[model samples]
Target: MANTAFMKPRAVSDALSAIVGKGPMPRTQVTKKLWDYIKKNKMQNPKNKRNIIPDEKLAKVLGSKKEISMFEMTKKVSNHLS
Candidate 1:
């Protein structure tokens, strides 16, 4: 069975909403959308595939961090969801 908490829809913060849009969506969906935006904008670091270089919009969601790992991405994004 899937974890209920992970699947539960949560409200997205304004910064994140700008990237994924405003809505109550599951955490998995939110992550998927976030990746979609990252790929669409070619934000992944060429030297290191695990690292993501946030664009102007993503920078807002990721705070002031210049670059972040894929694992860290999920952790940081969780902060923007309630």
Candidate 2:
């Protein structure tokens, strides 16, 4: 049988809610939406490219930090989205 628990989609909350809207959205969708916002807002730090500089909305999800690495971003965002 399939592992339903692992496969189940997580809901958005806390910080993620600010960027992606309130949810029950899948993780894939959340990531997509976040990238969309990032691209739209130009939040990625131009110097580093791998780092994202949080704007007002992104700050909420990033624990009020001003910047985060792209790799760490996914893990951090997951915390707010469960």
Candidate 3:
């Protein structure tokens, strides 16, 4: 059975919304949209694909760090979801 928790819609912060779009959206959808933006912009680090090079809009969502891992991205993104 699918985990309903991940499918429940949640409020998204302004910063996150810039990357994932304005939402009351599910975490699954948020992740999907986020990945779509990332790939579209080619944000992944060349030598280290696990690292995401957050752009200006993404920087607001993930902070102004130089880079962050996919795992860290997930963790930080959750903070923007309520």
Candidate 4:
């Protein structure tokens, strides 16, 4: 089997509520779901491809930042995980 250590899954319970709905999901899944939310909502900042605009719910998780870059996004979002 593929080594799962480097690819730990995110628990849905950990991320669902903060991410979209509810979770007990893996990190990869959470990231996927997050991207899904982003894409579905057109959250990517058009002017700057690396930046993202958080919606109301996302803003809460993002600490009220109107915009964030892809790099900063992960750091900001980690706060909502626990």
Candidate 5:
């Protein structure tokens, strides 16, 4: 079986906690919550589905980047976890 290390819960940073709530949560749940927030806020770029236009809350987590690719989004989010 594949290792489950990546599934272990980790502390969410303040910036991310603002969006996903404060807690130690698994990476999958974090990603799911992020996507849910994105969809709820209609932050996805219409022209490019893979790109995300972060809203004010996400901006803080993204270090104020106006937009980022989905892949890059994951990388940035990883920094917020311990």
Candidate 6:
């Protein structure tokens, strides 16, 4: 069976809400919103798409990292979700 854990709604933190919007939303939706925000803001590194260079607002959710990998992004984001 497919894992449904990611589909379960979770409480979103204030920091995360700034990026993903108000949530009580599923992880999938949060990730989708994050991606939409990133794309809309053109945050992906030109040299390496795997790395994201976040803007001020995104930096808050990402803990102000200079750069972060796509894989690490999920991990970081998870911290902001309960």
Name the candidate that leads on TM-score: 3
* CA error at residue 1 for candidate 5, angstroms: 2.5
Backbone clashes in model 2, listed as residue pairs: none
Instruction: Please give the lDDT score for candidate 3.
Output: 0.94
Q: Tens-digit lDDT track for model 4 on 21-50?
A: 675445666677789989988999888878
Query: What is the number of backbone collisions in each predicted candidate, taken in the order shown?
Result: 0, 0, 0, 13, 0, 0
Over 4 Å off, model 2: 1-7
**Per-model TM-score versus the true fold:** 0.94, 0.81, 0.95, 0.75, 0.93, 0.94
Worst 10 residues of 2 by lDDT: 2-11
- Tens digits of per-residue lDDT, candidate 5, 1-82, equal 7558778999999999999998699898899999999999889999998999998899999887688999999999999999
**Decoy 6 TM-score against native:** 0.94
Candidate No. with top lDDT = 3
TM-score result, candidate 4: 0.75
* Ten residues in sequence with the least summed lDDT for candidate 3: 57-66
Cα lDDT of model 3 by residue, 1-82, tens digit: 9999999999999999988889999999999999999999999999999999998999898887579999999999999999
Query: Which portions of model 1 show Cα errors greater than 4 Å?
Result: none
Write candidate 2's Cα lDDT for 1-82 as tens digits: 9656545678888667778878887777788889999989998888988899888888878776668898998888878766
Measured on C-alpha atoms, candidate 2 has an lDDT of: 0.82
User: What does candidate 2 score on TM?
Assistant: 0.81
| lDDT for each residue of candidate 6 in 2-40, tens digit (9 for 90 to 100) | 569999999999999988888899999999999999989
